[model samples]
Target: MALTLALESSSSSRGEGGGDGHGSCRPRESMFEKVVTPSDVGKLNRLVVPKHLAEKHLPLPGAAARAGGTVLCFHDARGGEAAWRFRYSYWSSSQSYVMTKGWSRYVRDKRLAAGDTVSFYRDGARLFIDCRRIRRAGVVPAVPPRQPQQAFFFHNQQQAAVQPQQHLVVAPRVVVVDDEVEEARRRRCLRLFGVNLELELRAEPLLLDLQL
Candidate 1:
């Protein structure tokens, strides 16, 4: 493209016939004309459409007579262009302006969704439009670390260790004793009491003899 532009520039300069034999050349006019500038472009309007608009015609807001039943050209970032038709009509005592044809194709190609914004512009004598897609902000929760299956048992042990005194209470145990063992304990007690009584009676008789 640069080479093409350079060649066109050289050819236009040659066409001016620059030969006065005094190292002088006639001034030549620029072959390329200035097209639309950034300041010349302005956003005419913006529209936020719903999902249903993709299948149905898109309604535009403006003077119906100016845009009614007229063809507008759209240019994309890739320099590709497509022609779309604008239609205006009256329905039930109300006027409506819409893009009747070529709209569905543009929407499908761009994969537009609900909440997506579309803006129209007036550049020179041409109509141009651009789209801005709306995105939702989301947050993904963090997953907790997994514990082993035996964690429950270890958790109980940890609780017990934290309060050692609470786990130190001993439960009483029941024992069965034989009748022969009970009888032997009773006989031993009787023998010890019987010997003490006999000694006391003998000491009383000696005291009576000394008094006489």
Candidate 2:
């Protein structure tokens, strides 16, 4: 395949060109799409292209091409060019073609994972790549049930000392918060015992203990 890549910089998806007053039409463009595999996003950091797709869309590997694979520039959906050039090469051991050298960073920046879909569109000299993330069920959590107000204990050492027989109690303050976050904060307060109360209450822990 003889591929020349360039940014379209235009909004037109379908366009016409090359007319010599004769009845002739340009060949239809081809698109390559594949599902992302674990190795594509894993430590291997390379994408495996099928033999047919590689032959039909990528540069054929020769002695010089084998030594150093051709660098292909692919554009993203937002018309952003990739920071690194992707190397396209043919592997003899597995008799497969693969994309390497910059693939790792591409997947990382795109946040692509296994089971996602990646596609390549070849329009004349321009090439575009897009990613579609896999959809998972139950990703959005259901709304939690409403609960009573949250309370944090303030251990008054002075009050406890004054009335050793009676347990010291402090008035509870109300704050609107998620149940899980509030429960975690309550348990943390119980463990710290006002040591870090200012984090949740936004006031001096010792001062609040004394005032209450």
| Highest lDDT model number | 2
- Backbone clash total for model 2 is 0
Q: How many clashes does each candidate structure show, in the order listed?
A: 0, 0
In candidate 1, what are the lDDT values of residues 1-212, reduced to their tens digit?
01111212223333223221222112322111111111111121212223243224333333533434345464331123344433333232333333434554444444333334444433344444444333222211121111111211122222333221122221222111111222222211101100100111122222111111
Error of 1 at 164 (Å): 51
Badly placed stretches (over 4 Å) of model 2 are: 1-30, 61-64, 81-84, 138-212
lDDT of each: 0.28, 0.50
Cα RMSD of all models vs. native, in order, equals: 44.2, 18.9
The digit string of per-residue lDDT tens for model 2 on 148-175 reads: 1132323442233322222324443212
